[model samples]
Target: MRRSGCGSARVRPVLAVAVSVLVAGALVGAGPAGAADPPDRVDNPYAGARVYVNPEWADRAAAEPGGHVVAGQPTAVWLDRIAAIEGTDEAMGLREHLDAAVAQRAELVQLTIYNLPARDCGRRAPQGELSIEEIVRYRAEFIDPIVEILAAPRYASLRIVAFVEPNSLANLVVNTGSRYTATPACEAVLARGTYLYGIGYALARLGAVPGVYPYLDISHHGELGWPDNSGPMTALLLQAATTAGSTVANVHGFVANTANYSVLREEYFRADDVVNGQPVHLSKWVDWNPFVDEVPYARHMRELLAGRGFSPEASVLVDTSRNGWGGPARPTGPATRHDLNQYVDSSRIDRRALVGNWCNQAGSGLGQRPATEPEPGIDAYVWVKPPGGSDGASGQPGLGQPYEPMCDPYYNPPRGSPYPTGALPGAPPFGEWFPAHFRQLLANAWPPL
Candidate 1:
């Protein structure tokens, strides 16, 4: 339910160095250890911890051919709707998942706290069950129940990494503007301050619990990679961090590329490279964004957030669930062509038709396997968005999700330069596991499973 756009590339040099220093601090566990000072808290929640593996998702994955390869790996349990809080006939409730984690001897459990009022304003489908005026109910029903379940003494030993509201704050940054890509729904959300209230309330309540680390979602490089977008987004997030009796301490860090297909790094090209006497950032694909991929984008954003008063211990997490563009089509090296477009097209690993394509992309693969502190400044490489789950429906009947044009492989936008949606066809509604997509992900996994 995220959309994409371009931004200016103007990150200061000092901030870049700050990223390295912060990463060094994280490596040595050096810092005030603000919220992490609690007996149950640690600088990195995933360090020396076994993340929870959802039995429901594991059963689905194991049912597929060759699924055992990844079935044992951990994935986040999403509380996307109210029904999900209390176990549905087909799914486990929040407490059930936590109990299962205890049984599995998992030290860490990842939970995605989605379902803000008027959620996913940038997209037509998968709208939240709450309305704009239902913010009170969102807190009373959604956030309250989750907090109560998590506060149970039996679950206190578990290090809970709660991914707070993916696609919520970032939409307030780019989607509320007057640009052609802007939607009326996002404008209303911005005007009403719905996202800030919902996210702030969730963070305050969740962070109050010991051992709970709240990582706010900041979208990804493809969405907020530019100075114009990133600057505004940093400001908005700061505001959200402090809203509704919440402070910067309420936030542990931020997560990027949640459920979106953006490569972890671009091996062949840099954002400022000049090819054919033209800046790579100016190319159609790069679109002038300073960050060529999620790593730099996330590190730079952490720097910005720290400068804005977040704790120095605040690190970053990347959702490497998808975005590994591997398989036979994966590029080995830089393109020899002098033309800028050709060079970018051939070298980039993200095979989407456009960076804005956020649906069930066709050529994407399982990215880096979930790991602890895989990169400097990254708290963890996580599977926040479970691989093989549908981003949304592609005009499939009997699927409850509405048809979003971006999910239609044949539907091209009228305003922007026309490009394929790159969405795989016959997909089910959002969050349902798709067998074909799972098989493709397995076949193209970067580390070869």
Candidate 2:
């Protein structure tokens, strides 16, 4: 969705400083709260299931987002709560400020590391995706440090996830807009097979932290089809990466999965509209958003992985700051023209549309789901995108900016509601649809998560 609607409540710097002091006291083992219950360990979807939650952005200041979403709380006080972040949007380099912020918060973080060299993934899309010929050079230029991080002692546990190309190699294939498939010779090979191999190669050469692994957010740059070729895609990517270096048959897993099952519901405008399928099915992507059909997808993904003797953990982080909540409050017809880029700011490229690879929307409320089933492993559902970061022209280009001013604070419903159960002043209904639509129009733009 485009980054518009439901503006935020700014978190003043003074309050942020105060909170930092309080949080720092706790970390040093002297807070009145007394250690915060060891951080609430839950059932491990992958035995050590850990969900990564990136801070809003270094520029926004944790204090601001904290004061916004966590309102009344100083971000400084919650610095230790940070887990991971999407370091950059372009195929350039990591944002040092964002990196520092993540490193400061979570002991580990995932930097949208890439394998594209002599070619850009996002910025330079038509460069033939990522060529095998460039793999070595790509690794030399981009992957060296990830390996070091896994081996580094001071930050041995400090980790990063190499989500090769904001779009997986699958995006390289013709047609399907990078949506996965198990058919066709080339598509299957590039996605279901080679991709993972490349990841493993990076891991072997770069070394993933013992507790960490390289994961594929395959849908980062494209839409997904049913019976997602996720299993095969994962296998191939890891196989390619590992085979490139390791003999251990090291398997790379998926960190995020797509659940883009949306219903095209319509609001009643006139009785004639329904007769002609006016309001209903008019919008195409109505009630459904990324997590709309997630559980089913997860189940399928789990079955596929487990069948291959792999137990993987997936992370469900929401890009909440600006996704339009409230479902399809209005109705649209088949030609209704859904706009995923509604919040995009044409004036500036800083639009926060969920266009391609970003998946933390408000409607996907899996965070509140209790850890019941474990067959298809899932550790935790977290708020990946902090609320209040302007969609476009809001933050730094590569390092996306936070929803400025403040976070639109409100309670997200407990569970199983079209929207989160609790009330959130949250952005408008389906406001995020615009940017995604905008990106889709661009031949090079990727799809929303």
Candidate 3:
């Protein structure tokens, strides 16, 4: 989930030229062999789904011994290069990748666009290279070329499942109050005005790309499960669509739990009200508490959006990449430790601290593989976040960096520290292979490696 850092002052000149060249090349790249007229979208563009296998990820998996289990796993390519100097490189790479897909006659590709200004809400690692004042440049230099590539007739036959800006809107919901959420970056954008408009611009551009299905990122249940946040969250989404100069119909759907580790379900069974030893309802879990997982979250969110004029075709895709808790459940009674791992009820166990925990979490496993089997209002359960890449620093703080809450030597009690443990320390930067996390994931894979 790292936002690639900004360019140093000395490298700005070089980066400027590189970006220009990248955009030029993408707009003029030779059309694919046997390119035909752009494909039309009379029905759902993604209805015929075949997930793309990212060549870069596959190559990495094959070379890393610990990545054997993930070697052939279909992972995604991120557009995190947005606003960074490397954006040009990523754009060029995407054109090349699309060409390769055309050559292979592949049907789908998972592409995540993550470089929004004030990304990660001014979080710990991978602070983006760009600033709020630079968002104009973001759209002009980064998104424009991306749209050109996707709209090109050469790629119209390929379905691009574009996961848009993972944490931008979610951060707005969870961090509106700067002091409480510890997100000064988000506050800065809100105070300056036009933050929502920025989102609108991205969506509008993406909406024009015929073969691209844009799924706006919404934070998971852990952060927005309360009834209080639901209305505001829904309103924020509506604003996003309105400001984008687009309607809900322009978007294919929304994506939840992107790169976050909230499991698909707790060990609850009954579907009627009073299920899970909680209140009785269609969703089976009471809304106010942290009990709502992704399934119920998507169901409720979609219904709310539909009420606001979104197309019924607007759906959801949850990232089931790391929620598989293959380990034994926590003790059903009292916990011997005060950390957040207390057994909340007979059937539910609290795993990570909250939805905000994005680091390499302990005891998490690989979830069900990418699939199109419909689940309630969910369009599909896909692994948008590639497995094996480190979430962030896990070991000792790198080079004079102080210890952070997310990394290893994990704070005691796990909920915000106060206790201690013997767990491994922090990990490498984002996108780099974390051998320890990779092994743990494979070993704990739900169906077993």
Candidate 4:
């Protein structure tokens, strides 16, 4: 809910300088309680890093009316700005993005680590074209080139905030051995740990870069939060570290809720909710009373990880782009309807079948803009998932394989009919813009867009 005036010509530079100072302060000496400080003791992660804002964002700021404010302003992109590395994407688009960072002499530029095999569980529209069998080659074709670019000497001074593989690690915990693994594709991914290997290799390689701050993705609270999924998540992190041949020490931090939406603070105030004579908050997993928001979730996970040997210096990052606009006003009583998102219980709001309501959900707003501020074990609140881009298409007739009841416009699962989530019907694919979503997001923006 942090607010700032519109992106005026006079305000942009101030914003940049403020951001630089913020990033510099956090990297140098911020460590969790009782953690040993690193010996290197660099004051600024972005110091001397050759980073710049992308020219496209600037151009849009100049030409696209409101676009100049949202577009040209900094937001991270994957592989290339548009998510694919083909054609001019590698030659021209990437250079443009990097060149802008350099032009502005930005201290940091955000980048996403996508392309894990069997990516997104084949559940969403951008499920990736790679099969589990072809993952080894995926490393060669997709990941390596990006690494080569980041590792290049020309960009040596730039601080790269690498957001590793959104939804990749969480999928390992949620879908691996469950009914979701019904397909051969899911089975292959589970058997091979395709995501773990993919993310591990990327982390080890990218983390080695002097200017890179590698943050592996830990899915949001809904997918793998406290009480329910704690043990499995701890084991997964340890396994991932082992697979990478690097310990948590090599990582700069871990990111949660990359593209998903789960507010960082739950509604419960006192952190005391008794269930069957036991306070739920007292439980190791349910560290936050109302519900486990990203802050407590990240902090608790860090503690759990420390017992297993994760670095205390490793920080947490949360993507606050869309979660700021809480979904429907908190329901007053038990849900009279079947749609899970609206269903509420006494202990918490939105007791849906799934904790995270991803999928181009409706009523979301532009969250806290990207910035580094130390709060509750988190390093920064970033807009890793660009605002206007669509999560997936609403189930319009022709789209293949991935369509589900949640996104289908004509069907509603509760009544044995399917319906799309609010913001989705008009959205495009993964990284493309959706004007409908843009209008809604701008209108619903927390600080009043």
Assess candidate 4 and give its TM-score to the true structure. Answer: 0.75
- In the predicted model 1, the residue pairs found to clash are none
Give model 2's TM-score versus the native structure.
0.48
Tell me the lDDT of model 2 at 397. 22
Q: Which ten residues in a row have the lowest lDDT in candidate 3?
A: 19-28
Off by over 4 Å in 1: 2-39, 396-401
Q: Decide which is better by TM-score, 3 or 4.
A: 3
lDDT of 4 by residue, 271-373 (tens): 4544445555554334343445677777777777778787766677787767666334543343343322222233343323234446666766666665555
148-266, model 3: which lDDT tens digit per residue?
87888778777777787777776776677733653666777766644576677778888887777888877787777676676677887788888857666667888888887777875
Q: Name the lDDT of candidate 4.
A: 0.56
In model 3, the Cα lDDT at residue 276 comes to 36
Strongest candidate by lDDT: 1
Q: How do these models rank on TM-score, best leading?
A: 1, 3, 4, 2
TM-score to native of every candidate shown: 0.90, 0.48, 0.80, 0.75
The clash count for each model shown is 0, 74, 18, 19
In candidate 1, what are the lDDT values of residues 1-449, reduced to their tens digit?
53211111223234322222222111123222222233456788878676677776666666678876676677788888888888766677888788776666566788998889988873556657888889999999999999998888777777889999988888888777766667888899999989998899999999999979999888898889988888999999998888998998989889999888899999999998999889999999888888889998899888888899997779689988788989988999999868899999999998887898888889889999888788788878888888878877778435555778877777885554478788899877777777888889998888777
Candidate number of the best TM-score: 1
**Candidate 4: where is the Cα deviation over 4 Å?**
1-52, 55-72, 80-83, 86-92, 178-184, 267-292, 326-354, 397-405, 409-423
Distance from true location, Cα of 373 in model 4, Å: 1.7
